[model samples]
Target: HRATFTFDLTGMASKTTNSRGMLPDMRSNLYAAVLAGLAYPGINGHPLTEAYGVRQRFIAIVTDLELPNDPLTVLSTCDECDRVCLRACPTRALAGEMKQLTIENTSIPFPLFDTFACDWAKRYSLNAQEGPQYWGVDESYPVPENRTAEEVVKAVTRTDWGVQKLHLNVAEECLRVCPARGTR
Candidate 1:
């Protein structure tokens, strides 16, 4: 038997509303915070993003059995890259360099992620002249073009089908090319 714990760290200190309209579900700040706090193996060592990509979700398991924890990753795998992730970002989401902020007296460093652009790419594919591709032509759906991120978010949120379609798609190119977790 085991117990589990979940945290809504979106309001922790430095987190803000993300482009996807998701709070804690959008980025991995809370996971990183937890890893840093517990001195556990960080995302950098994970096979998926090599610590360069944001964690998707986190859950803590409490068991009665004693077990050893994995050693903490002291170095970032991204430090060895030639900025490939930044260049591959479709929305330039993770392109910004590190920026430090003092939140609740604690200095925290993070990237200036552009949620607007990130959400756009995730919800709809950009077709050079046709604009937002919400559905394929075979579905008799017309794609919207030149719409702002806010407009896309509003439209996508209006229907269950829209929400499902957007959520089901994985459009982040940067997340797809990680040497550790990606198909590269």
Candidate 2:
């Protein structure tokens, strides 16, 4: 038996006390994708943009009980609104073209994104264009054109602020500006 649970994290998106404070949804999004993929391989387990309409934390459990497979229903209203998430990304992480991921004959279409760029803006909150100033962060560290996890870590650690300021400020413009939250 496989079961999936979701907990809404939209309420915390406005909090700015720490970088992770507003990142529960993003973290949970990844968790949900992994859990779902493991529980139901070959199904639509990939993270779809429509699912972010409302930030949700997910948990999946597999038991020894027989259960019927239930199709996941996602009520997405993104088609009606302007693509604010794409435009709001300061690092142009979400600027890539749309791509499709197919699993077991199920084709899932999603926006292509640069993980490094997204992480640079969200984890460090150093992109002034993403509104780090709102969280009282004055320093705007330039994001390297060729970004990598190692390089980003080195840059952050070498700074006077160091890792202590890692959670001081964060940007979630894409999630914050999503109009799908209202539907929830």
Candidate 3:
């Protein structure tokens, strides 16, 4: 069995001091998923979505009960998109390539990206070009051309900028501007 929890972030203010107001929403969805898992007694679930904000969490669950295969419609509109999501990345983390992953004999194609660079820009709010200016975080740490998880962490810590405090900024521009979701 599979479950999907959709969070609609439309009409919400983009810039905020509280992690763009996503933590609470994420927690709610997480709790729901947990409860659902518990109710199933002997179910195992795995999350499929990577990005935060206005996203769907697809949980592929396994159970003893037999169920019909009801595959969700793939968003083929991404193929026709102008690649706005890729261009919106302040760190240019998206590789602009489609990679396929086969799950349950179904091929899922998604855009490839540098996870380290993406986390640096989105999670840490390090990229000034990505609206860190809203938080008064003017420092734009350079993403290593060959970024590793360790190197990204070092770059953030080595800076004189206070790394301990929370730096709030609008993130997930790639997800926000996706025409597939009608967000554009």
lDDT by residue for model 3 (1-184), tens: 5543344223221122245354322112332332332111000011122132225442234356665644433333554558677777777777576555564565655445566666676666667656666556677887877667677678767645545366465546665565443332
Q: How are the candidates ranked when ordered by lDDT, highest leading?
A: 2, 3, 1
Candidate 3 residue pairs that clash: none
Please tell me which predicted candidate would have the highest lDDT against the true structure: 2
After superposition, candidate 1 runs with Cα above 4 Å error: 1-4, 11-26, 29-56, 60-73, 100-109, 123-150, 153-167, 182-184
Cα-based RMSD of candidate 1: 8.3
Off by over 4 Å in 2: 1-52, 74-76, 103-106, 128-131, 157-171
What TM-score should be assigned to candidate 1? 0.48
How well is each residue in 44-130 modelled by candidate 1, as lDDT tens digits?
Answer: 212223343443444445467676654333334555566565676655556546665554455444455555455445434332111
Ranking the candidates on TM-score from highest down gives 2, 3, 1
Model 1: how far residue 174 lies from native, Å: 1.1
Residue 55 accuracy (lDDT) in model 3: 52
> Please, what is the whole-model Cα lDDT of each candidate in the order they appear?
0.42, 0.51, 0.48
State which candidate has the highest TM-score.
Answer: 2
TM-score of each: 0.48, 0.62, 0.57
